[model samples]
Target: MSTDLIFSDATKLAELIRTRAVSPVEVVQAHLDRIGAVNPKLNAIVTVAEGALEAARAAEAAVMAGVALGPLHGVPFSAKDSIDTAGVPTQRGSPIFKGRIPDTDATSVARLKGAGAILLAKTNLPEFSYSTETDNLLTGRANNPWNYDRTPGGSSGGESAAIAAGMSPLGLGTDLAISIRGPAANTGIIGLKATHGRVPMTGIWPRVPRRNWHVGPMARSVRDVAVAYSLLAGADGADGFSTTPLRFDTGVGSSPDQPLRVGWLVEPGFGLIDSEVAATVQKAAEALHGVGCVVEPVRIPALEQENALDIFWRLHRMEVKPAFAAVTAGHEDEMFTISKAMLGEPDTALVDFVRLEQAAERLRDGFAEYFQRYDALLCPVLPIPAHAHGLAEFVINGRTVPATHSLSATVPLNVTGLPGLSIRFGTSRDGLPIGVQLVSRWFAESTILYLASLLETASPVRDLHPDI
Candidate 1:
């Protein structure tokens, strides 16, 4: 095995495989070995495709026989347990469907395979993906590889942990609200939640109800993300919300640090921020200032005046609840207690839904106004880095935090369907990785990613693998 492949990006791996310097089977084997070694410790992947290697061997033979390869070519990646893969357990982290397997790979999964990326395993997620920690009755818990005592952060926690610990270079993750961003922030890896309808949501679970969800890439670098996003973006006729993919003129524009405008919101948008989270965000603001961007204290004008969590609940109430309701029918007692506590709560009171819709408009308008003056907004991904495992409550700075939506600073962006990127910015005094999210205008991920790339260059935090 080449020492280079251990942590190499997809771009590098593709080129190596293209040149025949690397075999697809070898590349897949390395990821398989990494999963075998790390999954036992972190529990990131719930189901492994045992025959994945043999498939990779076949792929290698095709490459050797002078066949054209897909963009992903020989790379290995994982899908969240929620995505269907033919002949593989597609358990969404619950015991109800223990032996369940689909007859077809998800549209995204099939497309990726058609393009040549190998499906290595299915990473874990919260049961029915209701909580912020990735623990389910079936797959158990996924720990932060950086600090096992802390959570890797939910729903997409397993995806983030797997990438951070080098179990795989790339993986698929779905973000309804903060699933992708929060876990990436929690585990100190790169995660992006695409603009609403940017990626098709055909084969994913729960999309049959909630239409606001998006699927995107989680990986080590911005370029890796670009490749995944390109492959995943475009209308599939199945996802009606997706606009037909058309030519976007702009590439990733640079000049990372010039005397341009940047917004820094240290306050949790509609929640509270702890000292550590505040400090981490402050440090990022200062770093942006040092890099020549004018950082200013910006406010989310409608945050206090709006109930975004209520909006979140409403969007899910009519669309998502039925699917979740089915899950809670028999196993309500066995489910995460918090999920039961939060589920089936009334989302809107007719008048309240009207008011919340107005509020969403105001919030969107506020960001629209702010973006006219600033390039991007910076905030903490979560009020605190992945809270202590499964505690019913969180205490931040001598204040007892409310359970579900208390840590919700990132949900507003989801409502506006903007682009948010999480990068490893700071760690706690105890060494838990804390991340600051940079949000850009809708469809302008390049701006946020450019800022993140600059941060990566100035203070690189890479290759921090788990001891597991």
Candidate 2:
């Protein structure tokens, strides 16, 4: 019963709790037990919530009293360590901030708690949440649940690993580039990087390059992500970027009025992708086509002309380096590999910065033009499946590329502030998970999410879990 409870989806758990088939204490304790069992091997959850059981007891009382409940009432959720949690240690996986605790919750965390979800724990991440690998001096490293030697991707790698391992049914992860989606792909779970500014980033770290960062949900099912997004969306007033008025439809498990037009691409624009990953994307496109949606091979010329990966690195380096320098001023020796690497890189030239900014605008325009004819676009989430830990480079399609190349497909969405969803649709030759990315134009989360629900039903890898 405990095993089944830990593996249940967040929505199912909520329903079970509401119906009295299961109590909130049972749900929370099941997750705590799972974390106690698996977290030592994975190091995914750095700090378990202190008052989780107490919160669960209070929720049980509410249920017994027949009080109105929130959509996620009695469900247990986790958050990446970089996201602030009131009274919980949010060390950001760096020694510089060791033993640090925030007095307030991040907007994303607060919204989830507001929905009556208990905070289960805080997952691990790279130092300052900067790397594509989840490792730092403070928390050591997060191992993949599927294969201890492989990574779960980062900087939300630990969150993805926790969800995949059934330690938590839902989680909140922040994405700067590939942090949320790439990690989800690596773990064979689902993650949503909603339209930028749709969810407030208030109370999170490193506000510089604020336009690129996002907070979204990671879960085992699309419906949980959809419900969490509904609760997390809308302007918080405190975050200037989150000014999008509360007016969009969640559109989960529903179809548009007309047949949707979708496009899929894996080459020329997103760097060199593994054949297996590309084939999975092709299969997803075909699946959508099979469902009566008009799908075809397409390309966005801007991605080809202006490499999104290059533009992201050039612009973000200029914006984030100073922020890193400021925070690590007195704690230089405590800085980790990722923070050191960012600081050591040469500054972006003024001319290049201007050019890259314009190029980013062109990429947005390109997507805008494409969306005029297509409702959504499908692509690869990562160039390859999760690789062995601590590797500096990857060889894909017979070409060796820097580890940063993993950001090729994902950074473009961040650059344009567009919405993208990562869902597992296939498996790799090495028995690892492979996910395809679904993207939509700005503020069209409903389209991609609704379409994701359809793809979720058609996915060949449904209900698959890692044998932890």
Candidate 3:
């Protein structure tokens, strides 16, 4: 029962708890035991919340009293280290912020707790949550559960790994570029990147530029993602940029009556993608087509321009670099290699920064125009599957590219402030998981969710899990 509990999705776990099939204390303890068994090798969970069992006991009492329960009542969830969890240490995968404990929970974390979800632990990530891989001087690398020699994808790698290994049924991860979806793809789980600002950035570390930063849910099933997203969406007053209201009908959207116009691209007018990944994306498109989606091959001319990656890099380097410079000045040696490089770079001139911002706006406009013709765009989440640990480069379509280009297909969505969701579709030749992202216009998460539902149902890879 404990092993079965570890592999269950949050929604199912919630139901079991609500029906008195499992006590909250039992659910929490099952996950704690799973974490203790698997976390040493994966290093996915950086810090376990101090009073998880105590919280679970209170939840069980509420259940026994026949009190009305929230949707996630007693379902255990993990949070990316960047998210504050009151008593838990949110080290942000860095020594600079070591032992940092916030008195208040992040808006998303608070909302999840309000929904009766138990916060079990904090997951690891790259230092300052800045890198594409989940390895830091503070917490060791979060290895892929499927293949320990490979990366899980970052900076949400820890959260993804935890979900994959059954350490937590659901978790929260932030995506500036591909942090959420990339790791999900690598780890064979579901990750949603809500439209920027839809989920508040309050109580999260190093608040990047508002238009690119987004918080979303990660879980094993689409329904779990939907359940968590409903609670996570909505603006918190602390984040001025999160003023947009979230409007999504999971029940209706999950089973849309009308056929959807889903535009999919394998190359995506950017970096090279492995043949296996390209094929899996095609399979996803076909699965959507089989489920009444009018899948078509399409390209976004604006994304073909070389400036997409440049625009993303420039904005991040210009804004996030300065924000962390003060803390990193004398502590360069303590920071991760990527963090040092990011902070050490010279600042961009005002004119150059403005030009980059304008370019990004144009890119966003292009996606807006494309979305008018299609309900959502489906593309490979990452150009390649999980790669070797400590890898600095990858071979894509016979060409060597810097590993950072993995963000090419994903960062554009962040630039456009659009929503995207990655769902596992197939497996690589090496048996690594292959997933694709369904991207939608800003605030059109429901459309993507609808398309993802179709793919999730049709894909044979849904029940596949890594053996520890």
TM-score of each: 0.92, 0.98, 0.97
Indicate which candidate wins on lDDT.
2
Which one wins by TM-score: 1 or 2?
2
Per-residue lDDT value at 186 in model 2: 97
For residues 355-400, what per-residue lDDT tens digits would candidate 3 score against the true structure? 9889988898888789778888889999999999887888887889
Indicate the worst ten consecutive residues by lDDT in candidate 2. Answer: 248-257
Q: lDDT of all predictions, in order shown?
A: 0.79, 0.92, 0.88
Query: Candidate 3 deviates by what RMSD?
Result: 1.7
lDDT tens digits, residues 178-212, model 1?
88888998888888887677778888877676455
By TM-score, who's the top model here?
2
Q: After superposition, how far is residue 305 of candidate 3 from its true place, in Å?
A: 2.3
Q: Candidate 2: TM-score?
A: 0.98
C-alpha lDDT of residue 165 in model 2: 98
List per-candidate RMSD values in Å.
2.5, 1.5, 1.7
- Would you list the clashing residue pairs of candidate 2? none
